[model samples]
Target: MVVVDVQNDFCEGGALAVAGGAAVAEGITRYLREHRAAYDVVAATQDWHIDPGPHFSDHPDFVTSWPVHCVAGTPGAELHPGLDTTGIDELFHKGEYADGYSGFEAHACGTGDAGAASSAASSAAGRPRDLARWLTDHGIEAIDVVGIATDHCVRATALDGARAGFAVTVLTDLTAGVAPDATERALAELADAGVTITDSGTPS
Candidate 1:
C-alpha cells in the first residue's frame, strides 16, 4: 500500500509545513498511475487533529511547540487537491491527541485508553489501518510505501511496517523530506531496521 500524507498542513505555507512537501504528491500520483494494478490495495494517511490537542503545547522533548495544525474541519487538514485519490481504498487519520508524530499510535488504534486490552490492541493494531495489517488480513505480505515528509510520518510508518513482519520497500522518489538532516537521519534509521529503500524508477 502507498501511504501519502499530502495534507495541507504539511505543504508549503501551512502550519508545520515541510520544505518541498508539495512535490511529493506529484511523484506519488505518477507512481500510482504506473502501478495501479500491480498491488491489491492503495491507501493514504491523513493527520486529522482537533484544536487544543496535546501536540500544540510546548514540550521539553521537542525543540519547540508548533502552532495549531491539521485541525479537524480546517483547510490545513484536507488532502492536497492535486492528488488523484481515486484508486486509494482507505484514508486513515492520525494524531487526535498531543504529540502525535507517529501514525501507528493514532486514536484508531485505541492508544488513548490505559487498559491492558487497549494497549495490546494498540500494539497489535500497529499503524492506523496499517499496510501490514491490511495485507495480513487479506493474506499478503509485501508492501511498497510512498508518501510525503520522509523524516517523520513516512519513516515511522515504514519502520513499523518492517517491524510488523511485512516485506517493506520505500519508494524514494515519491517522498519529500522535512529537512535534509532529518531526512538523512530517517533514511539511516530505516536502513538499520531492514527496510529496502528504492527509487521509483526501479522495479518493486
Candidate 2:
C-alpha cells in the first residue's frame, strides 16, 4: 500500500490544504489498523520541497505551480498526526529541487521512522531509492494507493505505478482531492489507464 503526501501542508490548516484532507488521514489510520495484514509492504510518499524552482510560486496558478508548502525542516512538511504510521516500512521524499508529482520520483529515501514518521520518512535528505526499484526489490506486484490529494500526487503516483506494470488501485474513500472536478478528471484518467478505483472495505 502507498500513502501519498499525508503531510501537514496538505491537511486542513496546510499551505495547500485540501478539503477533507484531515479526515482522510484519520480514515487511513483506521483502515491500516484493521487491514494491516492485507499487504506485504506499506510505503508512503511525502512532498518534501526544497527550492523547487518554478514549482513553488509567490502567486501560484493552482494548476502547474502551487504556493510554497512542505518545505524541508518545517512543521508543514511533517506527516499529519492523525495518520498512525506504525506499519510504514520505508518512505520516499520527492520534489527536493524540481517539480515531482510522483512517488516514483527518486529525490530521496528513508527506512524506519517512529510513528513520528517514526519510520524515518525522507525529507530532502536520506539516500535515494527509486520507488519502482524498491517495489521490484520487494517483489510487490500490485499496489493500493491512498492519501491527501486525489487529483495531484496520488494521481501521478497511481499512473506511474500502472506504467511500471503493477496492478494499481486507488482507495478513493481514503483520499481527498484539491477540487471536485479535478478529482473526477483524475479518476477518469486513472480508470483509462487501467488502475482500479475502489474503496478500502472491498477485498483486495
Candidate 3:
C-alpha cells in the first residue's frame, strides 16, 4: 500500500506545516497514474487529531505546545485538495490516542484482528500494525512510499516498514522535507538501515 499524508496541516501554510509539502501530492499522483494496476490495494493515513489531545503537550520533542492542528473537522485537518485520493481504497486516522506517529499505528491498522494476531506472534509485540501490517497481510513484499514531511511521519513509517521486513523504497521526489538537514539525516539513516531511496522515476 502507498501511504500518503498530504493533509493541510502538514502542507505549506497550516500549523506545523512542512516546506514543499504541496509537491508530495502532485508527485504521488504522477506515480499512481503510471502504476495504479500494479497493486491489489491502496491505502492512506491522515493525522486526524482532536484539540487538547495528549500529543499537543505530552512530548518534549515538540518545541512548544503546538497550536492544535489536524483537529477533527477542521479545514487544516482535511487531506490536501491536490492529492488524488480517488485511487485510495482505505483511509486510516492516526494520533487519535496521541501515541501514534507512523501511519501503521492508525486506527484501521491498529484495531483489527490482524493486529491482534500479529501482536500475539511477533517480538515487535503490542505495537499496532499501521501500513506495514496492511501490506504484509495482503501479500505485498515490498512498498514504495511517498508522502509529506520526510523527517517525521514519513521517516517513521519507512523505517518501520523496513523493520517489518518489507523491501521498503521511499520515492524522494514524491516527498518533502520537514527540515532540510533533518530530512537529509533521516534519509541517510534509512539508507544505512537498508531502505532504498529513489526518485519517482524508479519503478515500483
Full-model lDDT for every candidate: 0.70, 0.86, 0.74
List the candidate numbers ranked by TM-score, top first. 2, 3, 1
Clashing pairs in 1: 54-98, 55-98, 104-127
Task: Tell me which of candidates 1 and 3 scores higher on lDDT.
Answer: 3
Candidate 3, lDDT over the whole model: 0.74
Per-residue lDDT tens digits of candidate 3, residues 1-204? 566578998888888787787777776777788888986777778888764455685344543245567887789988888788778766677877574567767745432334455445444654445566557667889887788768877888888888888898988888888668888999999999899998877342
Query: What TM-score would you give candidate 3 relative to the actual structure?
Result: 0.80
Candidate 2 structure quality by residue, lDDT tens digits, 1-204: 999999999998999999998998899888998888988888888888888999988899988899999998799989899998788887788898988899889433555542234224423335445788777867899999999789999999999999999999999999999889999999999999999998888332
What are the models' TM-scores? 0.79, 0.90, 0.80
Worst 10 residues of 3 by lDDT: 107-116
Instruction: Single out the weakest 10-residue window by summed lDDT for candidate 1.
Output: 106-115
The order of the candidates by lDDT, greatest first, is 2, 3, 1
Which residue pairs collide in model 2, if any? 112-119, 112-120, 113-118, 113-119, 113-120, 114-118, 114-119
